[model samples]
Each structure stands twice: as structure tokens, then as C-alpha cells.
Target: MKAGDPGDCAGYRIEFESSGPLLRVRVTGAGSYAATVDYWRQILAEVQARKPGGLLLVDELQGPALTAGEWQSLVDGTRQQGLETVRIAHVKPLGLQSVEHCEIYAREVGLEARVFDNETNARLWLRYGGA
Candidate 1:
């Protein structure tokens, strides 16, 4: 969890913490999913441009469930941007069902996304840059 104020993009307030080439994006909260994604698309574009091969750790906690289209958006966005990320650690959304569903979709589409219950494990994966 991030403290203090973060840079706001659309409805999503983000904290960008980096140790050299590794970047971690902590999304604290969002006003709306649609607006958040809209902003995320733009933010991701910038990230892709700025750091192509850097590991990205995205910590999304207690977030709303994502629709199929939303999942597709992530899939398409990563593919379109050709973001060859070293690794992406996504802290699981609240609730087991949501986490399971998200994991299933990720596995099916080869999203290269992993969901974790806490930041500790997620951070470990990001630190190691491997599964």
C-alpha cells in the first residue's frame, strides 16, 4: 500500500516507485472502472515508451470485478504495445471468486499476469523477475 498523494491519471491515482529499471505502479483507488481504464491506456502507452523491458508491478487491491471486455483491453493493450515486460505482478482484487476468474482468464489468454493475495508475495515475484 502507498501512502501520501500520488499522481492522478483520470480516475486512478497512481504511485510510481522504481529501483533502476523496475517500475511498480500502485493504483490506490478509482472513481470508476471505465474512467480508470481510459486513463490506464494512456498511462500504459507512456510507460511502454519510457521503459520497454522493465518489470512492472501493478498492485490493485480491493478493486471492482473486471468485465470480459476489460480483460480483453489488457490483453490487446499489451500485445499492441509490444510491451516485453520482464514481469508483471498484479495483486489480486478482493474476493476469491474474482481472483479465480481473473486468474483463469489470464491463464487462458497467456496474459503473463499473476495474482497474489498480498503485496509481500507480489513484491517478491517482482524482485525476482520470474514465476
Candidate 2:
């Protein structure tokens, strides 16, 4: 349950771990448009290569600071690739509004997405499908 190291960027960490079928991502730092896309591309590449069949956990991210275009691209990429369950966890209170917007966008793109302020709850839902 340790956090990963930050990327070359100033305020971003991308760590990957496995919890059963889920690929857990622990991201810490600012989530701007370019940096967030790069981070996710790297992680998604790994997931695509592995082709795991569980959930994708985006943990401790402080984002949706992305422009609308970036958000659309992210959602489109996920849908096009047909990634497994994707869940986002935002520990800080940075982008609640943006998270809501992203949730709606995700739904429109035919993905089931949710946001969580509590990391524990986020993990639980991702792990158990909110049973």
C-alpha cells in the first residue's frame, strides 16, 4: 500500500500495483492536462499490455484541471480501448466539481464511473462493485 514515486514532472507520482484483478494506480501531485494524459497513457499502456480484467484505480489524484478537450480525449480513449472498470479517488478537495462533470461525461461515453472523497470507500467499491 505504499505510494509510487513522482514522474519527471514537478508534482506527479505514478505508481502501479495489483490487487487481485485490479490495477491500482496511486497518483500524487498536480494533474494538469498534458501531464495527466501522459501519466495515464503510460499506465494504460501497461494495462493494455497486461490486459487485466478487473478495476483501474486512480488514487489520490487532484485533477480534472484538464481542459474540456483533454477530458473528452481521456474519456474517449478509455471507451475506445474498452478498459476494465475505472474508478477515481481524490483525497484532496481540489476538483469536486470537475469530478462530477467527468462522471457525467464518462456515462455519456458508455462507461460506469464514480468519484470518491474517501479513499477507503473508493477502494471498497472498486474491489466489490459497491456490494
- The numbered model that scores best in lDDT is 2
| lDDT per residue (tens digit) for residues 1-131 in model 2 | 22333355547777777666666666777677777677767666766755555545554556556566667877777766645444443333343545555666777877666766666776677666652
* Regions of model 1 farther than 4 Å from truth: 1-5, 52-63, 93-111, 129-131
User: lDDT per residue, candidate 1, 52-101, as tens digits?
Assistant: 33435454534567676666655555554534444556664444334445
Report clash pairs, candidate 2.
Answer: none
Q: Supply candidate 2's per-residue lDDT for 40.
A: 67
TM-score of 2: 0.71
Collision pairs in model 1:
none
Error of 1 at 114 (Å): 0.8
Residue 121, candidate 2: alpha-carbon lDDT: 71
Report, for every candidate in turn, its global Cα lDDT versus the true structure: 0.56, 0.61
